[model samples]
Target chain A: MGGMKKLINEPADVVSEALRGMGAAHPDRLKVDLENRIVYRKDAPRAGKVGLISGGGSGHEPMHGGFVGLGMLDAACAGEVFTSPVPDQMMAATKAVDTGAGVLHIVKNYTGDVMNFEMAAELAAADAGTEVLSVVTDDDVAVQDSLYTAGRRGVGVTVLLEKIVGAAAEEGRPLQEVADLAKRVNDNGRSMGMALTSCTVPAAGKPTFELAENEMELGIGIHGEPGRQRLPLAPAKEIAAMLVDPVLGDLPYQQGDSVIAFVNGMGGTPLLELYLMYNEVQQLLDRAGITVARSLVGNYITSLEMAGCSVTLLKVDDELVRLWDAPVNTPGLRWNA
Target chain B: MGVENFTNWLRDAASTLHENAAYLTELDSAIGDADHGSNMDRGFAAVVAVLDEVSFESVDELMKKAGMTLVSKVGGASGPLYGTFFLRFGTALAGAEITPATVGEALKAGVGGILARGKAELGDKTMYDAWAPALDAYDDAVAGGADLGGALAAAAEAAAKGRDATTPLVARKGRASYLGERSAGHQDPGATSTTLLLESAARTLA
Candidate 1:
């Protein structure tokens, strides 16, 4: 009762109800497989195009599901809040979206997500002869290896990779080329996130973790797993620096590097603070002699009502930039053709 | 032991998980997403519902149904891990009568499936921490000519000890590992639930 109030009815119905709302809101653009908990583009399995699929927990809005459209994902599997989707859901999505060109899976590097996707890919291959390739995004620099105990988590960079690679798939790239592009984006991008507040899972009906008003968790994953270090809250500039420094250093972005700078809000933060953080992030990049070729500032990938922001820096060449500017029509992200 | 005893073991497990759901959630709240308790409880409730509605011809059918239910209903990592455990365990006993040796082999298959699914080694501070030791103890007891109940009791004790041992170890897998050093001192929720599973087996399977 002492946590942030969410506007959900029965805790068990949260994901299904939200999907229902999404389907109602975008019937022309999206298709919801209610039983399997998959979100598909209305025109999926585009005859000669490579199918791109991605999914994870439900709390992160505008992520795997919201990114499904003409130039993004063909399908997304939704798990319960903050839990990885099961293999069956992934298999259904894979088979539903696969054109003759085969399918590509954009997986985040969480253990459950990776395992489930692997199983689904195997099932898809053995059952239907659907050729599937997968790329795992692990960009968070908070904990290289920590308690949610795998490799570094896939964080903000996932949003950018989806966009860039989605464009490639939309252009009728082969499954191998699309898979390679997705992996390149993951390798060139680095991200770091911090949380000012913890989000609540609907079924749990309470905050997953408690944080003091003055304290913040740095290097948080999308699931509200405790970050690498918790420290006293700082100003937007310092926080931006805290996030940017590790990202810039880890990848060692060169002074003349052209990059896409993404500032993402963890669901609860407002646009006003996000812009302020973006301003600080820009200034830091300028000082480091990095040119921001493209910038996306919004709540594209988010934790459920957790108040914080993550910064992703992806080094891009001409081709990547061109793909970034391509048309994308989805509920979460849209651009003119 | 017979099919009735196997069914009782599952029923006891469901009840035990229901009783300890909050405790499991509390442990998860420390380092995980805080749904382990609720997820397991819902899955077992579904399993029990299925158990009541249908009369099974064999223990394998009952367990496979329970596994399928967990996979569909739980909707998390636990769903697949627990689901795979039951599916493999039941498959190992397919069309065969449940004997003390078969029970041990079934448990071995189940634990092996969990290890394959979750990919955790010993000391990773996961449910494997409990399951590995429990499996060893069960095998040791059976090898020493212990009865079914005696071996199960030994397995339960070892699992409890393994659950306790999770504290103070750095997590190398699962959600809890995200905390690094901070993860130590909090018992793993998966390990706790696994202990409940073994305890239920000890209490009713014989």
Candidate 2:
């Protein structure tokens, strides 16, 4: 197998084993429904609080699952590596998390995810009469209709939206209001990702694709799909510029615009390189005269062990900045109580 | 054709998928997430287990159980697509006596369910590429007074041709479509697997 060595005991057991570890590691903060493969807050379905749910393939650690708690998602359904969760799991999560106010499904813009979530929402509505709203994040500017063939993909912006919208829900906003805030976040945000190496899906027992040591994939998706373009590997500054330019140009963030700058690492990347990339990204933003009102730098969303990073810039006003600063206590991200 | 032949068909499909699992995954590696073979292999294995565990009175009952097994066990796009295909096919055949013409109708309904679920059209370079032509050929054979075995043979041949025809076509759907022109020149994994299903039907359903 031509890939990084994984610690998994068996390929089929990876997701379930990881879920078990997560439940043990964070007993007080989160609860695991092993049968449904859902990760829920310890005290989910907060009365009158609109529940937030997001899920996707399993490789992206600390994403939907790691973000579940205090100010983020109420629950997250996990699928097998690089596969969308089935509708039965999502429907179970939806009914489990709905607090009678409503539930919101934060879906990434992948075909399987979209279809499965849509089916779950319909089932939830028919079975329990739970009002469910969905917002699909499609902020990746790398491949629009042409390259992706599935409009634009949701990327780094999903983490920021989950946080911001989670805050709005925490304040007891109605489902519609919280969903609208999520849409605003998605609309204002644009992201671009690039990969230096391909990630392995465990069951496949190898890397999804291969890249020569001297080459890199630009505009890559989180699933390890090939990017829009491949080029010779460049320095951190050039890579940062390559990621930032499209994000800024696609949304046309202008001078004096306040924005949240997120520099996210794919799973295999280290913080040292992320900080280096962030430093270059910040300089580019400074030169463009866009004010970075809030910033996040880490591996918030990932593609197995792919070595790369994505940049998301969301134009924000004071309200979003306030929400971004709100207290969030989760396994992955934490702030003041 | 009777329920015994259908049972044998399911067993043969499991064997065929097991034999071709590596090949399917290899094709998927070129244009998709590289799990099609393993997913289908695991799903059909589960179906065989279910087939061994219980006896069903009707063909629809057997097929529905297999479809449910696929939906629960296979955890990718193929899980839902192929699962729905069998479920709808079985549903269309509910309480009906097995016949060549009815098999053609059941396949048509099954492929239609895939279209409704995956929403891919002709020339999208997906399983529909093979399914649409295979269904047409089956219908044509049945209309010409061919029996179940003859129609399935025609369908399997058409599906194989359609699977080969997928090469050199730009994908417009599924994960492969993300590669744009790069997706060309690679045979689609879904079509390959669809061909396998048809070939098994031709061999064992007769």
TM agreement with the true structure for every prediction: 0.97, 0.97
lDDT of 1 by residue, A1-337 (tens): 4754778888889999999999889998999999999999999879999989999988999898999898999999998888888888988888888878999999998877887788788889999999999999989888774444688889898999999999999998998999989999999999999999988887777788889989999989888667878899999999999999999999889999999999999999999999999999999999999999999999988999999999999999999999999999999999974
lDDT of 2 at A77: 94
Evaluate all candidate structures by whole-model CA lDDT and list the values in order. 0.89, 0.90
Where is the poorest 10-residue window by lDDT in model 1 chain A?
A142-151
Error of 1 at B70 (Å): 2.6
User: Per-prediction interface RMSD?
Assistant: 2.1, 1.8
Best by lDDT: 2
Reference A-B contact fraction recovered by candidate 1: 0.65
Clashing pairs in 1: A146-B177, A147-B176, A147-B177, A147-B178, A147-B179, A148-B174, A148-B175, A148-B176, A148-B177, A148-B178
Which segments of model 2 are wrong by more than 4 Å? Answer: A1-4, A146-148
**TM-scores of chain B, in order:** 0.97, 0.98
Docking class of 1: medium
Cα lDDT tens digits, model 2, B91-146, are 98998888998888899899988999888888889999999999999999999999
Candidate 1 regions exceeding 4 Å error are: A1-4, A146-148
